[model samples]
Target: MTLEGWIVIGVIFLCLVFLVGTTISIDLVLFAGLAVVFILGIIPAEQALSGFSNEGMLTVAALYIVAAGLKETGAIHYIVKRVMGNARTVKKAQLRIMSPVMVMSAFLNNTPIVASFIPALERWSRISNIPVSKILIPLSYAAILGGTCTLIGTSTNLIINGLMIEEASIRSLGIFEPALVGIPCAIAGFIYLFIFGDKLLPVRGSSMDTFQDPREYTIEMIVAEGNTLSGKTIEDAGLRNLPGLFLIEIQRNERAIPAPGPYEKLREDDRLIFTGIVDSIIDLQQISGLKPATNQVFKLNAPRNERMMIEAVVSRSNPLTGRTIKEGNFRDRYDAVVLAVSRSGERIDQKIGDITLKSGDVLLLEAHPNFVQKYRNSSDFFLVSSIEDSSPVTYDKAWIAGLSLIAMVVLAATGILSMLQAAIVAGFLLLVTKSFQYSSALESVDWRVLIAIASALGLGSALQYTGAAEYLAVNLLEFAGDNPTMALASTYLATWLLTEMITNNAAAVLVFPIALSLSQSLGLNFIPFAMIMIVAASSSFSTPIGYQTNLMVYGPGGYRFTDFIKIGLPLNLIVATIAVSLVPYFWNF
Candidate 1:
């Protein structure tokens, strides 16, 4: 291997470290590495930025707008309402969630599909008395499996097809060609998750579980002087049965009542201390006379309805990391009031102003809508996310949005227009028809994912331009000389391994050239080999990092890395087996 090959290997190793070892954004890590290699003259400048203009990348960006249209118009909400019907059992519930997501994911991008479903699943779990932990992982896996059933199912498929058109001799793939192998894989993967997933899945405590977070937040809610609750007994005040929250005590003037009995009478200006999940704070906010302990909230400019509730994970680089909330003047500094703080399954139990902030601490905040837009990209936060249904939806335009999505699929699937062309028209219709606002559409695109995909493409290009990919492919294929099926299996295995370690689109980009080179080396049709790479690359079930949907579910599902390993390992093998076995049959040499 040349020095360039060694450099590519070293750069990829560093990327893995940045992705796994730290909380840095994946986009920054990938772009930073791409810049390093480009500066060192390992790859040309044009190739480094080529992904920015790649058809696959742009199509992904366009599709995000379409997904946003569906969400903004309440089309997603309506669909979830109708489909998630009276799910009485876990299996039935999983089916309800998985079936819709699978079908939607085949036409829509899986990222937004999973995002739209999350809130629905949460709402359903609460209503059905089912643990959300059992449902979220399967939701992600279903999207992944369903994506394999069509060309437009995932960005990775378009990426592989785009690469084939530019680098290989074969014509572009038809919309459903991969389905020959993909449909089988999807069915097999779905069955495995449906049957064995619940058993392998851990029953993690919900966010409100006392055992999960021991240091319960001590929130002081002061009753108004003239409110109806002022003269009522503790039980008569209607304070009990606050889901996931408990009224621990009451404070009146100089007296402290510990664990007040149900009949204990309440008085004006009585202070109530509740210990529970941060999410339940909204319930307290709704109580007519119960104002939060802090007056700082009264100073915020926005009205309650116009503002939003957000959760941000403090990053190491945040300037507020070492300071107390009081010392930092967090409310004034960020125009947001800290409602609660949680750290590693433990809620912080102290006066909101006195607690010190730390990296990885989750802070629940009540802030203006602009707070998210202002600090979403700040380095101080590893993640800044708004809670689901936090923003108002345009219910009237929902059918328009739904119909627009259908049009995009029908046009692209029928080859009346390319996926890219159809997506552009659909995205334009969304904006023009007021189904999605332009400003909102721009925000809806996961630019970080796009940047990461582009950067990974650059890195993949570096391998090809430096001759490293061909060098590696030739040496790797020598062992599977005579048998094409052996070669096919070997190709699937390599691509699958790469996908598990890196972003799926990048994995496909990096492995495509190798798949092509091996095809030529064996004098076999490149189509079957390309199909194997596509399916193998998109089937990223073994690790959370392998797919975006998995990562999105990790925190919400209360999942550990090993949780994915336990469930996803077998499913990964299931899809790999079906894909590898069926590829040669459909596109035989």
Candidate 2:
């Protein structure tokens, strides 16, 4: 390898280190690495930036807008409620969730499919007495498997198809070409889930279970010394019907008022004790004059009202992981006050000040609304989400959004419009019909995912431009000399491992050139290799980091990292076997 190739390799290794070893955002990491390579003259500026203009990347972004329209119009809720009706048992529930998801993901993008299903399935899990953990991972894996079954199922598929058209001068893949291998893998994957999911997946409680917590906490909130509530009754102060929280007692002038009634008057320095889920207790922090009993909260520079609520999930790589909330000076560092903390559906006791933070600990915070937008891409949190409901559904436009989606699918499937054209048109129709505002649609797009895909494409270009992919391909072929079956298996396994380590689209882009080079060197058809890349890249099941959908469900399901390993690893092997066995027979070596 030349100096440029070695430099590229070093950059790729750093990306892996920063990604797996830290809580940093993948998009930032990729872009930084891509930028470094660009500065080094490994690839020209146009090549480095070409991925931003790639048809496949744009399609993914447009589809996100369309999915947002569907979600913001209540169309997604209507369809899920109708299809996932009354599945009482876990087995039956999995079947219901997986069946429709697979069918939808075959045509629609899987990211939004899994995102829309999460909240609905959580509610379903509550009513049906089924654990969400058992079903959420399977839901993600099912969508991934389904995405392999069609040309437009995932951006990765389209990306690979585009590369084939460009590099090999091959005809664009027919819409169903992948299904020859994808269908068998999907079937095998579904059966593996049905048989082993219950046994392998954890039985952790869903977020709904948090409401049933019987533990009471003596949460103290001091009515600030100069508060308006000092002269108002409990009802007058809007203390009634505080969901899941009860004002059981109050202390004023060092005297306790037990079972305070709605008509009870309040006074300054009154310490309030409420018992409820941490989610609700955190809501109390939003009240302007009602400050946490801990004096530490008042030390923040921002007033309570100026501060908004954000939920930050701590990752292992967070620098504050081992420190207590007070010890860490969390508020001073992030300009956010920790209002409440939860771990695996259980609330940390009222002395949250003393509790140590750990990976996966969710902190309900009081900060500026932009706090979420600011730290959302930071490495300190595994996931940063706003507590506010900014995008409520416009129910009046539900039917319009639904009809638009159906039309987009029909038009694209019938070849009246290309997939990209259909997606763009559907997104425009969504904006025109008022399903969502232009700002809302733009916000709905997960820009990080797009940036990551685009940056990864640039890296892939570097690999090809440097002759690195061809060099790697020649060596990969040495192991499978004179054996097409071995070459196919090796390529599939390589793609699967790459997918496990990085985003699927990036994996497909980085590996396509090598797969093509290997097949050409061996005097074999490239169709089988291309089909294998589709199946292998899409079948990312061993780790949460392997796919976007899996990470989306991670916190809600209360799942540990190992939960994915136990369940997804087996399913990964099963799907890989099915793909390797079938791709050759269908595509012919």
Candidate 3:
């Protein structure tokens, strides 16, 4: 090994040590390592910074906009609601997410599938009271397992297949050739996760879990006619298990059903009274079939989609302080409808129109985004602030977002466009069609995840450019001696280690020629070696940086570096054992 190779290895090792031992951010840790390699003259400036322009990295960025479009239009909610289907337990939720994801991943690119699911699953986790950490890892793993089943399932499979086609002597793989071993590995993975996931996955809670809002407000919503929630029971409608919110009663045309049972059916125009904190109220506003009972919300000047939720504290000097909301012409006077009011952490029992505004009472208002600017310094209130992500969902444009996603998938799958191109088109469609705002699209992207991915790619480039990856693979393969089976195992181990250390595609590319050389020298068929290489490269469990999907979920799942090692290392071993044992049987050595 050269001096540069040794330095690259040492830098990567130190990065891993810091990642496992400290709470520092993954992006910072990885970029720091890349910087070390670049500064040491091991890799040039262009090679070190190449990851920022990587197709895979930019594809992830574009996909974030696509996912954000789906989320902002409330299109993802329909998919999540159907897929999750009222799963009550952590195990059930995992099953619901993993089963279909695995199947879908078999035919589609797993990256976008995992991308679309991350936000939806986070929302689902909050609603279901299941920790996000428990399901995200399963989601990523399921996608990876499924990707190994078919030719188009993952890029790694196609990369190896492309290499095979390039060689005149080597036979190309069939569409389902990998499935022979892939299916058994997938089944093993499913069994392992189903049986032990609940215990093995961490139970880290989101920020919303720790903070309990002291101020509770009573709000009323009407079931819109012909909406999805109408004619469904309370439980079936998903209104029964809302966190920090409770259904106090359902007001029918003439009668009131207090503490409505879970099985009680909701009729159109049924006024459902809920007592909850501001967060849950915001959640309720997003539901497609539910609308604030106050007609004043519709009387606002700005379009519903353009408005936002604001909190205003009433001042003694305000003219409407002593008057009932309806009597004070609140909507006409302030151009904002009071959704709910909180008085000293107590719930107001009166209807929104009937509540008498008092000094120091906090008001949750729905109005144009400028409401804060207009009244923040005015004597009309004490403090005024707009809530983040509180805009009304653009439900009307949901189909546009949904169709754009479908188009992206079809275009990418059929080779009409590359994944990056398809994602770019989809994101563009979303912006032009107003399905998602450009500002929200920009905000929706997790810059940290993108930076981390690019940094990891840069590190992978350093390994390849420094010849560190090749040196390590050669040293490891030399131990196989004259045994073909031992050589195959060594190749798999080498590729797997490289994958954990760098990007899977880079690992496969670096190991491909070496494995081929070994096969030629041993006077054996290269088919088995190729098959093992495909599986080893794609089986990037054990570390978050090993796979794109794993990194996609790292921050969202609130996982540490050790979290991947603890659960994924075992899965890696299981899949590796299965792949090695079955590859030679399926393809002759």
Candidate 4:
């Protein structure tokens, strides 16, 4: 290896060290890696900022908006409610539910799907009487499979597509082009999950709770006169949906009924047994239908004998996602009280004491009973034990928020907008529409992932600019000696391994230039070869560390490291072979 080659290898090694060893932001490591190269007087100055313009990065950003929209409008919930709704067995449920999850992922971005579904899936476990450990990993895997089906599905596809367009004048990625093989790949993956996903799943039961479940909810709200609920049937006022509210009795006519008669008229002062999600209950009480007992979000009036704070994520299918804390009546319904919320690394402000909750929004609740129980079965919220409640925000436009995000995705997926343009538009819309909220979305951007991508892209650029890629190509050719199929398979395997250890985006950055270089060196159609690398890079299974969606399940699903290896290895190899074999035929290498 020449000096630049050795330096590149050393930098990669350091990057590996930083990635494997510490929690420092990955973006920082990436920037530092490239800085070392720049300081060494790498190829040129103009190229340093070139990565900012890479189509892959933009695709990632735009996809977030699309995902957010999909989540907001209840588009994904169809799959959640139907296939994933009340799963009984792990494998059966994963097969049924993960199938749609995969389909949705092919259409939407991964983050929102992941963030929205993790909590929902957790809840689904309790309802189905299945252990959460069994399905969470599969949930993530399904998302990956789904993403590989379409060009707009995952960032990896977008990156490769962008590179292809730039280098080969391919115009744009076809919507169902990847599906040519990705469909079969998905079908095979489902089969693989059915056979092995269960054995590899972590079996986390519902009893490992860090907080208590509350008993009663004290709420204050005004009874709307002439409303259908007033002076009608006693059972008509359904408080089951509200949060933090338990109707011991109605304090009306200077009398309280521990239990109101079924035929008795509402009389505008009827109190009902309403319990469950805390935020929904609180917000509901402030509205006209129910008056607050006092004023402060109807905070628990009586002092508790034992109070504990527990954090919980809203499971993907948790019925609690769309409703507010007030609507859920959490306290009265479930005997628990909510204190705060955290979503996408952003806190819920505006007195989350009275705010509605969202999926993936972490809630801090003060309750009783340290033992773990599956509240997810009855409600959409889960009790989290590790992280504390973050601060809150003021933005509140659920419908519009969902819509704005969908717009960006439609444009990009349809090829009306480039991934980069789509991403820039999505980010801008996120800020303008207040979907992410000013304070939270900025904080939620995952700067580490961003920087890591930029730096890795720089390294890839360097390899291409410095003739290092050519040298590597020459070496690969020498090794191949003459067998193109063997060379193609080897290249595919190399990308698969790299992706298993690094983010798919990073792997793409490192692999694409080399793929192009090798294809050119071989005097073969660069498109097919690039597609092979692309498919291989995107299909990194066998490890949770390879993908963010996979890692998100680790803590929640209580999964171990080996679980991924056992299940992912087979799926990974199978997809790799399929891609390598099919690409040459599809693009005619």
Candidate 5:
């Protein structure tokens, strides 16, 4: 190996440990490393930064906006209602609910698709007295399967496509490219989840919690003197500022203080309760110069009468974002109270006092049932009302969004409009039609996913431009050495391993460049390699950490680590075998 090869290997190793060993945000870490590579001349600056403008990155961003539009308009929830309507039995509900969900995921962003169905699945499980564990895992798995069905089904597909076109100018990847292998794999996966989901998966709350939520760690802590504004009320103490402190209880000496006053003095022995985000407690302790009482970055709602949690999606065109909830009169103008907010699986625990409203932040509103209905079908927000009703469509306006989206899709597919432009235009039109609010759509776009995609794409570009990808491929081929099938298997297995440790999109971005090189060297077609990369990325079936959809259901499903192992391990292996076998056939290699 050359000196550069050793350096590259070291970088990859450190990246691995940093990602898996610590909670340092993976997106920032990878991108920072990519920047370092450019500074070191490991990658040309153009190649290193070109990924920022990659078509796949834009597609991912645009798709989020479009999905946000659907979510904002109550369209996704509308689909869920239609799917689960009159479904009585757990078995029937799973088939009716999960089957369609998997199918929908094939066409949409898999994460949103899974998230969109969560409430409906939970409701159905509760109504049928079925264990949510019986359904949620399958719900997640189906979405993963659906993701494999088309090029746009998952960001991994688009991302890998972007990498290939950039790396080698491969045109074989465009236009319904993935359906050849993806459709069959999705079909097989759907059947597999249907047959084994219940038996293999545990029921929700089958363990410690009443829900299938993960094992939450509970810790104790006390406040320290000399902290900034120690004499300030708890409200001013910035207890809310402390990350990972999900307040559970407050202790005074030996007695527990349930709800201490914000103005209460920080007695030497006062303890605060907290829940998630525990990792950041130490940082809070250091920054605030507060002694780490057993409780960590310790950190709810107004009175039951005044505080309320309403789940509402920001309209795609909402202008309320970048402004505090107070500015919009969220409580007054909306006739509802914001009790809690959930965004892309993470909860915003801050007091709704003055937090800015973002689109796609599922505002859990606390309000009267009467007012909740009024919020439903409103263009400004999506009211997640349990009471179902057929919306009186402004037929003209509805078609405007529908036709615009279709035209965008058609234009892109036919090569009239670049996919990036198509999505951008679609997002804008949704706003003009008031199908969703523009400001809301922009605010609601999952910025985290966007960052992750951009960063990973940059990393992929670095690896390729620096010859890291080709070097990795040559090494693999030296071992597999002329065995095309083994070469395929090696890349698939390697991608799967990385996914088990990092984001699936990141995994795809890392592996696609190598897989592309492998295909070219072996004189094999690129489609099979592309197929393997796509399927492998989606095959994060083994652990909750492997996929966000899995993690979202982790706590809610109350599943143990072993729970995923028992159910997902087998599914992972099965899909792996089927994907590898089908890819070669589809690509005729």
Candidate 6:
């Protein structure tokens, strides 16, 4: 091997060491490696910065906006509500979550699907009395397994396809081409999780379960007319088991039912009273069919979607302390309407308008985002703070967002437009429909992931340009002793090991040139090798660092590092075996 080839190999080895041993961000680490290669003059400037203009990376960026649109419009939340029905056991809950998520991930991006489900599953765990640790891993793994089924499912697949187009000069893969092997692997994975998930997964409690807040506020919410919750029972409506909240009573047509049963059905305009901590109250506020009982929420100056939830404590020196909320005209004075009140860790049962203000009373208010900044230092309240992720959802535009996504998928699958073009069109549709603000679309893109992918692509280009990949491929073929099956297995093993150590997309990019070189040396078709790369690159189940989704669930699930090795290692072997055996059969060597 030449001096430049050896240098490239050494730089990549150091990159793996840092990625595995340190706490540095993946993007920064990979970018540093790319910079080193560029500085050494191993590759030209165009090759070094080529990844930023790659179609796959830009498609991933555009897809983030599309996912943001779905989230802002509450479309994903609506689907989760309908599919996550009652589950009596851990296995049933896993089933309920994994089935839809797997199908959804086959077409949509995997990261957003896991992101949307994490909080929902956390709440569901509290309600169902199931430890969150058992459900979160399955949520992430399901998305990963499903992403292997389609071209647009995960960024790794898209990156590989892009490399094929630009480097191998081959046609882009069909949308459903990977499904030939991916479906079998997904089915096998589902079966494994269903049968062994309960015994293999841990039972640790989540952060929400261990923490107890003393302050409880009694809040009243009404079932909107012609809403989904009107005819459903309390249990069916998902109101029976809020972790920190209790359904105290129901008021319908001047009649009160105390301690409503789980089987009790709700009617239109029925006012339900609940006493809970602030966290659970925030969850309740986001439910689509429920509205605050007080009409003041609707009378606020700012639009509902632009408002935020704020907690403020009343001071003794405040002028309105001696008067009831209605008598003092609180909304007119503060430009915020009080939704719930808690005093000395006790629930205030009086109606919101009838509750008399008291010193040190903590009020939950619905107001504009500027409310906190405007009164942070004022004597009107002791402290003012806005809750994170408390902005109201725009449920009215959900259909528009859903249809835009469907149109993008149809256009791409039908070959009417390239994946990048389709994603951009979908994002534009979302912006013009006002489903979410443009600022939100920009915020939704994970810039770090994009940077990591682009930098990794540059490193791959360095390997190919310096002849390092071909040298490595020659050694790999020598190890396989001229056997194509063994060569395929060797490539899959190397890619899988790399994925478990680094980011999946980075692993795929760094290994791609070598696989391409291996295919060329063997005088065989590259299709099978490409298929194996997709499967191997995505099979990142043995560790949290290997995949973004795995790391996402780590803290929430309260998982140890070995927790993944214990349960995920076996699944990784299962997927690897299925991919190696099926790829040659489907695509031929």
lDDT of each: 0.75, 0.75, 0.89, 0.59, 0.61, 0.82
lDDT of 5 by residue, 443-544 (tens): 655565455556555665555555555566456545666788888888887778667644577677777766777777778877677778888888878755
If the candidates were sorted by their TM-score against the true structure, best first, what order would they fall in?
3, 6, 1, 2, 4, 5
Q: Which one is best on lDDT? A: 3
Estimate the overall C-alpha local distance difference test score of candidate 3: 0.89
The lDDT of model 6 is 0.82
By lDDT, the better pick of 3 and 4 is: 3
Candidate 6 C-alpha lDDT tens digits along 1-589: 8999888878977886776567666678779998999998988999899878876667767877887787778886777667777785899889999999899889876765675566556655665668999999999999999999999888789889999999999889998999999999999999999999999998887436644767888899999988989899999888998778899999999999999999999999999999988878877886789999999988888877668799999998889998999999999999999999998878676899999999999999999888999999999899999986576774889999889877887887676888689888989998997888887788777687678767766777777678776566456545655678887887887778767644567667877877777778888888888898899888888876567677667766877666788889999889989988999998887
Stretches of candidate 1 exceeding 4 Å from the true structure: 17-25, 52-55, 88-91, 103-137, 150-180, 199-389, 416-428, 433-447, 498-531, 543-566, 582-589
**TM-scores of all predicted structures:** 0.61, 0.60, 0.97, 0.59, 0.51, 0.83
lDDT of 5: 0.61
Error of 1 at 346 (Å): 27
lDDT of 4: 0.59
The TM-score obtained by model 2 is: 0.60
The best candidate by TM-score is 3
* Candidate no. 5 TM-score: 0.51
Q: List the candidate 5 regions with Cα displacement exceeding 4 Å.
A: 1-5, 22-25, 32-41, 86-94, 101-184, 191-404, 482-572, 579-589
Candidate 1 backbone collisions, by pair: none
Worst 10 residues of 4 by lDDT: 386-395
lDDT of 4 by residue, 509-529 (tens): 666677666667777766666
- Candidate 3: tens digits of C-alpha lDDT, residues 70-137: 88888897798899998999889889999999999999999999999898788777777789999999
Query: Which residue pairs show collisions in model 2?
Result: 308-367
